[model samples]
Target: MKMKLIDRFGKRLLYGSVLTALSAVLSVYVYAQDGKAGIQEANDKVRGYFSVGCDLMYAVGAILGLIGAVRVYQKWSNGHPDTGSTAAAWFGSCVFLVIVATVLRSFFGIQQ
Candidate 1:
């Protein structure tokens, strides 16, 4: 079991690394194009993508927070022993998602 888990992990890590490297190389190639037009095109595309991503993040965070609130309320009403930890986990994830989205937008220099 241990050996199988290790093998699976190694394979996953290798695949992830390979994909990351491939994307990096492709992005570099795209950005290396000559002329101002090429650079502006790339910048616009990236900015659009970032804007969409941030919007999606906000939607997802709102949904997650709602679900978490409901779950916590149910657990609290039921007097579950693990309710506190479960609530904490859910709230924490919701906050983290919002924070990450906000930070990414700021880091990308995106103007609302």
Candidate 2:
């Protein structure tokens, strides 16, 4: 008896379908005409980004380690009951960061 507004006008699905079709067509055209230069450039960019990330991670790990050491020292001097757990948590985080950075660098074969 009553017509719903959505049934009368709903273009979301149509728009998505059109957009997806356009992207697929564009990708196919790009792959059809591509030189190795583009791939090599992309690879170099990725390696540079990864190297920068590794260096940043190392710096972060050092800062964390220093802060953790100071906190652990304060707790130990006060003879806090949870000193051991606190120290373990802080040191563990620092070690984790350093280890992850190392592992990723090796895994990616990023020579710096």
Report the number of the highest-lDDT candidate.
Answer: 1
Instruction: Give the number of colliding residue pairs in candidate 2.
Output: 0
RMSD of 1: 12.3
In the range 20-52, model 1's lDDT, one tens digit per residue, is 999999998887776588878889999989988
lDDT per residue, candidate 2, 7-109, as tens digits?
A: 5445666788899999999998898576677788899898879989999999999999999999999999999999999989998998999899999999988
TM-score of each: 0.64, 0.67
Tell me the spans in candidate 2 whose CA falls farther than 4 Å from its real position: 1-39
Task: Report lDDT (CA) for all predictions.
Answer: 0.92, 0.89
User: What is the model-wide C-alpha lDDT for candidate 2?
Assistant: 0.89
Candidate 2: minimum summed lDDT over ten consecutive residues — where? 1-10
